[model samples]
Target: MAGRVAAVDCGTNSIRLLIADLVDGRLVEVDRRMTIVRLGQGVDASGAFAPEALERVFAAASDFAAVIRAAGVGRMRFVATSAARDVSNREVFRNGIEERVGIRPEIISGEEEAELSFRGATTSLDLPAPYLVTDIGGGSTELVLGDAGGVIAAESLDIGSVRLTERHVTTDPTSAVELAAITRDIDVLLDKTRVPLDEARAVVAVAGTATTVAAVALNLPEYDRDAVHRARLTADQLRDTTTWLTTSTRAARAAVHSIHPGRVDVIGAGALILQRLVDRLSVDSVLVSEHDILDGVALSLG
Candidate 1:
């Protein structure tokens, strides 16, 4: 059997929509898009979704509704992570989305998010056993370890781009004091995560942060998903990129060809998180994967 399906992933920094045709168990991509709505803005400080943040996400959801309807998707799954899970006024956020998209968003747990991310990211790669998939988002980072059998261990930490930026970054490129604070926060979370970082044979970095880092590491003129997918980013490459990002001004970072304008403010923190993971794991490089939780959500529809 075959069907058209849509998967929506709403995170703190952005909201993405993926529409695909599942033909006899294979997924064929039809449409993929993302909007930077900053939905998690102020959530870390306020413990609730800000009114403007809610509006931005609602607007994005409305646009996704149009895309879904036009694509004639038979089934759709909408998920909200990190920020949605922490907000106290989540019902308000849910109502707006349900009214616009006609589907109530599931605020999934960190463990479930890790599993979905693992399935979406690693199923097609011919990598070694016991792959470590790290998805760094705006509000949290998911670390999942698994092989062909399934997920072995998973953990989600509060260290993320947007959260880190809000918590520690105040200067344009992030002062040394800010960077050190962010590093401490990440180290604490890493210590709490149960997975053995040194044991994994390979690391697969997914989501916007990793992809963007790859695009820069490759020195691509612009964002290219095909080129970045499965691209190897060496420890030196990551360290160099982190140094460039952390020392660059906001305007300078935004000027980078592949750096998204929305991400410029928080990418310094994001890069640091990724860099620390690489150093802690002692891996030579990380293989970037564009397919992540969105793909996993689509597969779950079947």
Candidate 2:
């Protein structure tokens, strides 16, 4: 209860674990883990968890729990986001987690997920008041508006990297026709999120897509928390990157200088969503934050 805290965010696309020790009010990370399990791979169409997907997620959870235990984490909590919230077999997965990993994950609402994302992005920021936060994840994109260090309004849209890719980009190369449909769909989601966009001073982007774009912008070969945690991207950069990703095949995208190899497949839809949001909102720049729900969960415990 007094040494360290661990939080795992089990998402549709990835499983992320953060274990940190709080010393003099500062959190020092003891262990961090990320695995792409794609638990909700085809849930958009099938409306049920695929067998492989379920197995992968459960295995990831089992590994994460072992890591936390090995690290001797003092306190911990696990939460599942959009994917778990939307799935009908959520209880089955939750029950399985308890049996397999000795941990029962809490399925958080979209609004709650957005709020946690907001906390992770801005809690450490020295930004101007009234910031906008958005986390474009696997199955949902969370948008939030807040003043200073606290959230004011937040909402989660059903558009995410996996969902968009599965729903629109059916072709191996994602033909222009498919790309156009994804663009149009993302434009609509942006329209709905504009309510929060209009109220904030600057946009703070978190989660995989946002951070992956920032990683690309910095031209880093691998993820660098220090380099990307507060990396900034302009409107032009966002638009250009979106265009570049949409034009390249998955292999070609993987060969890019900074893009992560695992992220290549879904980056196209993710970038387009980010680009449309920035363009439609007329925002000049966006800052990317690597800390997301895990960071929020760790801090809230104190």
Candidate 3:
């Protein structure tokens, strides 16, 4: 049976809504958009959602609710990751969402987040099997290893764009010390990753960080999903882009139309995280995908 469904993914830095018609196990997109709410703002240090952050997220949720109603969505799922898991006042956040959206958001585990991200990134691609899918989000990064049969292994780490930047990046253009600290943190998490990186024949990276990097690498005048999706970049290209992003001033990075304004302060750390992952992979290049956990969540509703 075909049905219209909606999935809302509220992460540390942003919240996104995806509405699609599920027909024969495929998603016909209806509406997909994201807002930078920074829901996890100050969460790493405070262990709770900031008042302003909660306000922003609630506003986004209300708007999303309106869209869902207009789309006539039959089923909807809301999932919150990373910061939601760490926050002390989760019930406040949950109740507010349920009030506006008519359903509580699930604070999913890292493993589950990894699985959803893997499903979304691999579902539409015809790439080689035994793929390593990496999703670098705002508060955490998910790495999943799997083939056609399904996920072989997955792990989610605490290293993310906003989290790392909030912790390490205090200087403009990222001082060498700050960059080194960010690198060390990312390497430490990568060291603990359970997925066998060497087993992957293809590497597909999803979510905003990877997509933004791909856009910049392609030199698109603006953020073009058509051009960024499925774009492949070699290790050298990734390294160069990563270097530029990390060394460039916030003003310079914001000037790049492809880099989101919300991500300007944290993208350097995000790029560094992607660069380290690329360095670890045996493959010469990585494929970037715009489809991620939100798509997986929609598929699950069906």
Q: Ten residues in a row with the worst lDDT in model 2?
A: 192-201
C-alpha lDDT score of every prediction, in listed order: 0.92, 0.82, 0.94
lDDT, candidate 2, 72-132, per-residue tens: 8877878888888787788888997788657688899998888888777776688766788
- After superposition, which runs of candidate 1 have C-alpha atoms over 4 Å from their true positions? none
Give one digit per residue, the lDDT tens place, for model 3 in 73-134: 99999999999999999999999999999999999999999999999999967878789999
Model 2 C-alpha lDDT versus the unseen true structure: 0.82
Best by lDDT: 3
For residues 93-191, what per-residue lDDT tens digits would candidate 1 score against the true structure? Answer: 999999999999999999999999998998668888788999999999999999999999999998899999998877876788888899999998897
TM-score of each: 0.98, 0.94, 0.99
Question: Can you give the lDDT of residue 185 in candidate 1?
Answer: 96
Clashing pairs in 2: none
Question: In model 3, which regions exceed 4 Å deviation?
Answer: none
